[model samples]
Target: MKGYLKAHTHFFLPSEQMAEYLDLPEKTSYSALPPAGDSNQVLPLPDSALTLFYVGGIGAHYKLNAFIDAARSIPQIRVNLVTRKKQWDEAIASYPTFQSPQIHPYHLNANELDDLYAQSHIGVLAVEPSDYRRFAVPLKLFEYLSRGRPILVTEGTEAARIVSSFNAGWVVPYTAEAIAATLRRLQGNRAEVQAKAANAVSAAKVNTWADRARTVADTLTGKSK
Candidate 1:
């Protein structure tokens, strides 16, 4: 596989950490190309209170409890937990906080996610830290960026770098204290959220399908090779 990769004209990788796995030479280095988003997404203002949105798994690995724990500190703020109905039911059965009024759970189609994002301020991606996660960028991060919602991701992950690079959102560790502090500090700070959201939207612009295509074309043609 190393020989095959070395012989290739060019190799594109989402993150530089992946380069370590290949151990290729410096000349035939892998290009960094993370995921992109659609520009047609509806952009909306941040909510009055710092509203949070997350769509995906909710089990222990998903770190739903951590988000809930943080949200508990800010009574006014709400956390939108969108996931499978069965998962929600099971979670609700185990965690009493899942039934709290501050936590809103929904099972909606992919298109309906925009409506949810429309009313939210930050998009949460509480992925557990690992070498794979360190390099991998989740698609939902871009989805949040596309809708002008500031991202909320854990540190030591590639997504965190994207958020920092774009000034698109907060990159706190996946801990109750860290998340709560961020929420409490920005609670009801609509202007700050609005400002960062603009950056996120701008960041999304450069990560659109058209932009990705042009980048690939340029790389293939040796313009950036």
Candidate 2:
């Protein structure tokens, strides 16, 4: 560890805040895994009710309850909660409407997300506030954007910046009421959702994995393209 630290001249981190916290050196850059997805992976499902999905980590800090309560409140809106089976089961049981067929929970399978995303209209990015979290972006954010799904992110996440920049989705308060309200809005105004989905795919084109790789390679080789 000691020798490696000295031998390494540059550092590439995912989060700027993380790089600062480490305080390694001035020779630092950020390289997040920008996985670009094909919009064709998910086509509009011919469903009357608007569907939403959350695919990633799940726990208390994730504030998944807000998603649950919000989706539960709007019975017309459907949800797909994909996460680890144990954590998903444990967390979901805390809700009274855990048995609702409208709100489906799945044992996460990274390779099998296309169909799930295909059936959804929006992706939820719900995380509670924290010093570090405020400046850290989530990979799921990129996933949602890449797959042409508008997101429903909390008010204060750093990921919200990207959503705002691309006009990719709505950023609401981290509360069931707020999320429910937004879902209601989208349900009645699906054209708005379609517009945002288009924006998401446009954003994905500029921030794809190929883009990340080329940028990193160019930076490392001191080459200007």
Give the TM-score of each candidate.
Answer: 0.89, 0.85
Question: lDDT per residue, candidate 1, 1-225, as tens digits?
Answer: 667665775777887777887787777756888888898784777435667899888776565677688887678888887899988888878987768778888899888776678779889886666677788878888888888888888898888988999998988887889989988878756677878888988898888978888988998887974
Where does candidate 1 have its weakest 10-residue lDDT segment? 42-51
**Model 2: residue 36 alpha-carbon error in angstroms:** 4.7
TM-score of 1: 0.89
lDDT of each: 0.81, 0.75
Best TM-score goes to which candidate? 1
Q: What's model 1's lDDT at 141?
A: 88
**CA lDDT, candidate 2, residue 95:** 55
Error of 2 at 141 (Å): 1.8
Per-residue lDDT, model 2, residue 224, is 36
As for candidate 1, its clashing pairs are none
